[model samples]
Target chain A: DQQVKQNSPSLSVQEGRISILNCDYTNSMFDYFLWYKKYPAEGPTFLISISSIKDKNEDGRFTVFLNKSAKHLSLHIVPSQPGDSAVYFCAASAQGTGNQFYFGTGTSLTVIP
Target chain B: EPEVTQTPSHQVTQMGQEVILRCVPISNHLYFYWYRQILGQKVEFLVSFYNNEISEKSEIFDDQFSVERPDGSNFTLKIRSTKLEDSAMYFCASSEKGGRYEKLFFGSGTQLSVL
Candidate 1:
């Protein structure tokens, strides 16, 4: 049962450009969302997260936007760099669900130098 | 910054053999979890541990799977009888607090290969 889904398997963008990755979750119970970036052989590293009460959260070069009504969320990387190339996964967890998180399949983002 | 640590970066064993994957989560974290990802598949949750007990587990965690915090600082996952399909990268994660709002820190992962 895939509660969270990343429709796009891969995305590519030129350096110094914007790269957007989208994710959708079917479970309305999910109130917390997070994004993780993973390299080829490394474990996923936490990038950013947003609570259901907020629509957007921004970190250094990454920003996550959540649309509660649409059950969708997106990650935008501004001025993408080659180091930003990695597989990005979106994860969600519903309140009172203990510590279990549902993760999307992940979208591989390639930033061309 | 502290991080989760998984041992035996790679493990190879015969089918039906028992295997134990070890992990040491950050000292202050209260919640620990096991997740695995088969090549070309999404990361799958196996179990979550809190208060020295299993708080939740996924359907994929069957009778053959078990988790333990046998000591003060170590959390472990054991597969009684491994199968070819059990080959995957197993990740150990931890969070400072228990709840949906807290983010998890994941280990590099232990690659298990059942021949």
Candidate 2:
């Protein structure tokens, strides 16, 4: 049923510019959200995450903001670099459960130099 | 840094044949999961295991599928009498303490093709 969705199939941005990726989820049960970055022939690596209780979480150049009332979340990479280009997946999981994360189809990001 | 490892980067099996895929999760992780993606499709969960038993499984994991942690290091998925629809890239993931949901490390994936 695609409980999680990344409507944008791809995005492009110039180096030193801001890049934003968006995601929406239909499942209100989800309380935690995560973002993963992947390159060709490589495993997805953890980027950043936010709990439903908080509105925003940041790590250096990357930031994740969760809007619980909107059932939406976003990942923002400031001053994007060429190395930041990759496919980004947004995943959602419910609270206190071992249930696996439901992943979106993924959005490819291109940071042009 | 610990990472999930999967064997036989690619496998091509005949329809109705048996296939076994293997994975070695990070040593300290307490929970393990399997996910698969057909080309051009989103990743879907197959199963989750903890304490040598299955904690959860998806409907796609049917009678034809089985999972085992035969030893301390290896986690395996066996598909008995496979079919054409079984072709997909399967990923193994592991997490600590079971439920933070902040991060779940994934493997590069093992591509299986049933012809």
Leading candidate by DockQ: 1
TM-scores of the candidates in the order shown: 0.95, 0.95
Candidate 1 clashes: the total is 0
| Candidate 2 per-residue lDDT over residues A8-83, each given as its tens digit | 9899999999999999999999998999998878778899988888999999999999999899999999989999
Candidate 2 on B1-115: residue-level lDDT in tens?
8899998899999999999999999998878889998886778899999999999998899999999999999999999998999999999888876766536888999999999
| Residue A98, model 1, lDDT | 72
What are the per-model DockQ values? Answer: 0.81, 0.71
lDDT of each: 0.94, 0.90
B3-115 in candidate 1: lDDT tens per residue?
A: 89999899999999999999999999989999999987889999999998899999999999999999989999999999999999999999999876677889999999999
- What's the i-RMS of each model? 1.0, 1.3
> Where is model 1 more than 4 Å wrong at Cα?
none
